[model samples]
Target: MNPFRHGLLAARTAAVMPHRQRQLATLSAEGNAPLSVLFYHRVADSHPNDWTIGCQRFRRQIDYCERYFELIDLAEMQLRMERGESRRPAVCLTFDDGYRDNSDFALPLLIQRRIPCTYFVCTANILNQTPFPHDEAAGQPLAVNSLEQIQAAADAGIEIGCHTKHHVDFSHVHDERTVRDEIIHAKSELENLIDRPVRYFAFPYGLPEHLTQVAVDAVIEAGFDGFCSGYGAYNLPGESPFHIRRFHGDPEMARFKNWLSFDSRKLRKNFSLDFRLPASRIPTLPVPTTMTPAFSVLG
Candidate 1:
């Protein structure tokens, strides 16, 4: 990591993140106010990976989240926030990259549990049946979710969101035509596949530096209701046009809860905090479980 990134992470680690959770809990007891959008990539029973979690653990997380917060769809999340009507901290689950494993492994569990999810797909990669370029670089090529599976997800009531035509790097592209095409074409293609209006988008490599104002303009121009970034602070109620800030979740139960309950960066934009705050109680995280979800909204 570069010096700046390394330093920023160090600062976050030292911020006594657990204090934020206690604050959130106190606020919740008073009345639900905090809101967080959790981001995930893959859910497969595979070798250890930073981006993927096993199926059983994923199910456990869904169960825990359901118990803690009402799992509202992106539309409800925005509406509740825009109207200032949420009673408790809300949590939304999202996945990126449209991995076939998301369909083969994750989709079944979500379908069984009837949990709502927004899957941001790279249209070109799915159409072409290709691995994401990053996967190629790591010498671990993986399958992009196929249109058949994507359609099935939509059929099962999961929301379909855009991630660009080919997962283009918005930060590097200077051509206005490229940006427009990436945002517009991706939305159109996905809509055609799902036969529904694509309402949300997430910038490819959604860091501030990895994206430009031109890119943001294109998403708005293309008529998306909202968009998401790869990392950032949490979203409280009343924030509008719903630009979601997302963090990659950990597979380990304890580590992921630490992030869910107490990550210091939760309040900072893109996880950058200017003032130094002393650290606070780190709660014992819940153990992982293989139990199935208790209820399925779909059923």
Candidate 2:
């Protein structure tokens, strides 16, 4: 590791250790929050690459989640959170931009462990077998699963959600008609394929500032049960079902361990504080770099 990254990790460790231990003790006595945490774009493959985790490390994270949280499906999580119940801190797993490797790598492990999960798929990608622009720019091809494979996963009890038709940035799309088409078309395509009501949606590159009121209203009109975003935070009672937060996990074992030991409040505080800083005035920390691999390879 570079000196900068090593020092950042050490500092973060030092800064958060007491808080983590205290939180754990409090959790043990007072019990965990009914908070529902969502995770996205997980992979089980190799290291030194962005967006992919080695199988060993992936297994370890899953194991940790299974132990620490009640692993529930998204629907169950939504229902429980909506009811204001103080259930254990539960996690719902989701993958954005349906990838074939999700079927190839992660699905097998999830199946073996009987853990339920959801996949928010871009309908056009699967329909046309086209690579996402970002992946194409990176000289990487998307690995979206075929319709048959998606059906098989559904048969195995995985829930499929809509991730729009073309993975376009709805913010840049000035045409409300086009945005509505993207939202409605994707859900229709998935429902046709899965032969079930597709009730969930995940914004492509979801961020609060970027996702506008019109877009949110469009999704609600389309009859989605909820929507999720890439934001990193925990969901509390009465939080907007349309804009949920998710944590980004590094495929590296040490980084994953550090994340697990982290206090959620500290993470939230750091992000909020960082967002308020002038871009040029922001301090850089030495920590494991964020993974940027193709969403498809996240298996």
The numbered model that scores best in lDDT is 1
Candidate 2: where are CA atoms >4 Å away?
A: 1-18, 24-36, 42-49, 254-299
Supply the global lDDT for candidate 1.
0.70
Clashing pairs in model 1?
16-279, 32-88
By summed lDDT, the worst window of 10 consecutive residues in model 2 runs over 290-299
The reply for model 1, stretches above 4 Å from the true place, is 1-22, 29-32, 262-265, 270-299
Worst 10 residues of 1 by lDDT: 275-284
How accurate locally, in lDDT, is each candidate?
0.70, 0.64
lDDT of 2 at 92: 70
lDDT of 1 by residue, 11-99 (tens): 65446445655666666565445556788888888644667888888888877677656676666566655555555556778898898
